[model samples]
Target: MYKLVKPLLFSMDPEAAHHTVSGGLRSFCKLWGGKRLLRTAYGCEHPALRREVFGLTFRNPVGLAAGFDKNAEYVEEMAALGFGFIEIGTVTPRPQPGNERPRLFRLVDDRALINRMGFNNQGVDVAATRLRQLKNRENLVIGGNIGKNKLTPNEEAVSDYIQCFDALFDVVDYFVVNVSSPNTPGLRALQEKEPLTHILNTLQQRNRKGGVSRPILLKIAPDLTHDQLDDIIEIVRETGIAGVIATNTTIGREGLRSGERLTAEAGGVSGMPLAARATEVIRYLATQSGHAFPIIGVGGIHTPEDAAEKIAAGATLVQLYTGFIYEGPGLIKRICKKLVAG
Candidate 1:
């Protein structure tokens, strides 16, 4: 079905196609029997695929990564499609329309996408309100990936992160500090040792004060050097972070089969071009940490073999975004089925 519809979606603008699919799914899930029908067709559940990580139980290790539903609007829709978890946002304290138009582009030949979406989301409060209404769905685990607004400078970034952490404390299952998005100017600077430590430590302190603390994870870019990854590993240990999401997207457009003109478009590159490098980062962190913390592997996963490579490299869980767009809903079931078969 998705293969048949691919041409039409491909014909539309990338961002427009994204909105159409999201809106269509939102409407589809609203139908009386829509969720049931979706699950029957695309959902795959098996005991063999169950994973217990970060003191929480996951029905499967396959998750829909952040940036897909930036405002927590499609948890139910995505859950029905068989993802064990869904992460939303890169949300900020205030709502800001991200970078200019034409920020999202597709590199058709490379099966890749270049996006500068810039954490555009309806502020933390709105997402909190939306999430509060989802209390009834106990099986779905939601992760809030938080970031600072564009105008917010790096020195005061911790406050922005804390605001989001405090606002979403009651709703999300885990927290992902998103200081890695290239589209947000100086955002990646927060990933530096001193500032990153301050943010994570501050959040940890607040988490401890709460009645039930939620796990916190750091989402990093694949463009970092080995020395930088070493710093990240140390910071995770120092701050008691739950784990890391090994990679956002890459700034490097190395070896893509796509046209140079399109590849030259400024943004982080995701999809097949990102697979090996992302896995390398995951393997580095896992091996360097001696498997100390859990890692969510994401980047260029279009097939079960791609996912398996990440697992073999050390990812406890895996996520999909570009592959989901290209391969459709069945990718979730396909990956989960492969995990079960193993």
Candidate 2:
């Protein structure tokens, strides 16, 4: 099991182990009667877990967030693990190698992660190709979280988002415009009002004219002030966009239990320490916007209580990234079952 292998995995370089886990899943799922076997093992058969949102029906409410499966590589494998939905890709119009190594770190004592991975992905075209090959599933909703390449100047960032939208329209069920990753140089600046409006407005126009008009949502960082969050809510309403993912990861490191050793690691923080801040953002969004649209709450959700907090705060659905790394697959079932039972 993962518990036994985790120590070995923890010893490897974080990024390398990430690729290894993803690659290993791909290989394992290819073996004799593989993917179907996973469904039997990891799947929850309860009907109470089903829920509908975003005009789609999810088998469960828990989803795997974008960074976990960036290139659309293991949707089938992850789907087997009983996540109701999966958002793949912070993919760009073009691919880049991302930030340098040691870019990802485990703050083990705090049950958190700090990663400076700068949207390194295999480009939208490559991801779209694989996505197109997926056996269609109306049940398991897939969200495509798209972003610009790191080297692209922020001025032309909208072009990258637009291209990714056009390319992945036929494949993904929903879209998340990711402008909040801390690792990307100058990317978070796009979340500011003027630039955020420009990027979202362009995508809204395209979606209106497109073949399959999937719902589009913006993902925001938790570090924003009340004024900035108000700008975000205004833009969401103005653009007639779908919704918001309440948070990305946090740039702030205040009051972390991981101590200063982790304080020195230059990256975005997520996991248990992020729970209060992310839920606070969700609650703020809920209160400010008059509950205008849906919200996908993510960050530090590793327990049934955490999931409940997200729902209570106003997230129609929730996602997990660091939680999965720390708590393993059981966390999904636990959260989902708790939600369903309640």
Candidate 3:
């Protein structure tokens, strides 16, 4: 069904296509037996596919990455497609419109996307309410991917993270501190040791203050040096956080086969272009840190083999965004079947 529609979706603007697909799916799921029909067609379940990571039990290790569901609007709609988890938001404390139009672009030749969305979201409170209202969340693992507002200065970034954390605490299963998106000006600087450590420590402090603390993970950029990764390892250990999401998106356009015009678009690139580097970061974090924490590997996964490679490279779990878009829903079941076969 997706193959038949891919060409039509491809003809539209990338961001507009995304909205159309999401809205269409939501509307489809609202029909009689729609969600059940979706589940019957796409859901894959096996004991072998189950995973226990970071004090949470995931029905499978495959998850929907953050940017796709930035406002928590499609949690149940996506859950029906058989993802083990779904991450929502690079949400901020205050609502802000994202970067200008044409911010999201598709590079069809390279099977990748370049987006400079600038963390546009309806604020954390709205997402929290949406999650809180979810009725069928029994086995679903939801993660809140939190970030600072674009207008907030770097010095005051910690407060924004804290506000998001607090607002989402009761609702989300885990928290991903998003300081790695390249679209946000000066946001990556928070990945530096002093400031990064400060933010994590502050969140950790709040996380422990409650009766039950949710696991917190740091999301890092794939563009980091070995030294920076070492700092990341040290920060994770020092902060006693749960784990790491090995990459956000990369600004580097080293080997893209797409034309110069699309390649020159300023933003982070994700999809097939990011697979090797993302897996490399996961392996580095795992080996360098002696596999001390879980890693959720996501980037360029368009097939079951790509998902398996991340697991083989020490990713406790894997996620999909671009690949999910390009490959369609069957990719999740195919990946679970592959994992079970092994």
Candidate 4:
């Protein structure tokens, strides 16, 4: 079905295609027996596929990465497609319209996407409400990927993260502190040791309050140096955060086969172009940290083998975004089957 539909979607603008597909799925799943039908076609279950990570039981280790469902609008819709988890938002405390149009682009030749969408979202409160209203959350593990507003200065970024964390703490299963997106001006600066420690420590302090705390993970850029990753290990240990999401997206365009025009587009590149580097980061973090914490590996996973690669490289879980767009929902089931077969 996706093979038949792919060409038509490819003809539309990348972002428009995303909206169309999201809307179509939401509407389709509303019909009688709709969710059951989708489950029949796409869902996979096996004891071997189940995983216990960060004290959470995942039906499988495959997850829908953030950015795809930035506002928590499609949690149930995506859950029906056989993901073990769904992450929503790079949400901010206040609503902001992100970067300009043509912010999301598809590089068909290289099976990649360059997006400068910034952190455009409807704010954390809206996402929290939508998540709170989820009626069929059985076995659903949702993560809130939180970030600062673009307009917020670096000095005040901790407050924005705190606000988002508090608003979403009750609703999300886990929290991903996002200081890694390259699109937001000066946002990556927070990844530095001094400021990054401040933000995580602040969140960790709040997370311990009220006798309940969620697993907090740091999402880091693939562009980080070995020194930076070492610092990341130190930070995770120091802050007592749960783990790390090895990569966000990379600004480097080292080996893209796409034309110069598309490659020159200013944003982070994700998809096949990021596969090796992402896995490398995961392995580094795992080995360097002596496998002390879980890692959610995501980037350039367009096949079951790619998913397996992340796991083999020490990713406790794996996620899909560009690969989900390019390979369709069947990719999720295929990955689960492969894991079970092993």
Return the TM-score for each candidate structure. Answer: 0.99, 0.96, 0.99, 0.99
The digit string of per-residue lDDT tens for model 2 on 68-170 reads 8899988988987889999999999988888888788888888889999889888999999999888756367999999998888999999999899999998
Candidate 4 on 173-278: residue-level lDDT in tens? Answer: 9999999999999999999999999999999999999999999999999999999999999999999999999789999999888899999999999999999999
Using lDDT as the yardstick, the better of models 1 and 3 is: 3
What digit string (tens of lDDT, one per residue) describes model 3 on residues 1-342? 999999999999989999999999999999999999999999998898889999999999999999999999999989999999999998999999999988998988999999999998999999999998998895899999999999999999999999999999999999999999999999999999999999999999999984899999999999999999999999999999999997899999998989999999999999999999999999999999999999999999999999999999999999999999999999999999999998
Candidate 1 lDDT (Cα, 0 to 1): 0.94
Q: Which residue pairs overlap in candidate 1's backbone?
A: none
Clashes of each: 0, 0, 0, 0
Q: What stretches of model 4 exceed 4 Å from their correct place?
A: none
> What would you estimate as the lDDT of candidate 3?
0.95
lDDT for every model? 0.94, 0.89, 0.95, 0.95
List where candidate 2 sits over 4 angstroms from the true fold: 136-138
Preferred candidate (TM-score higher): 2 or 3: 3
Clashing pairs in 3: none
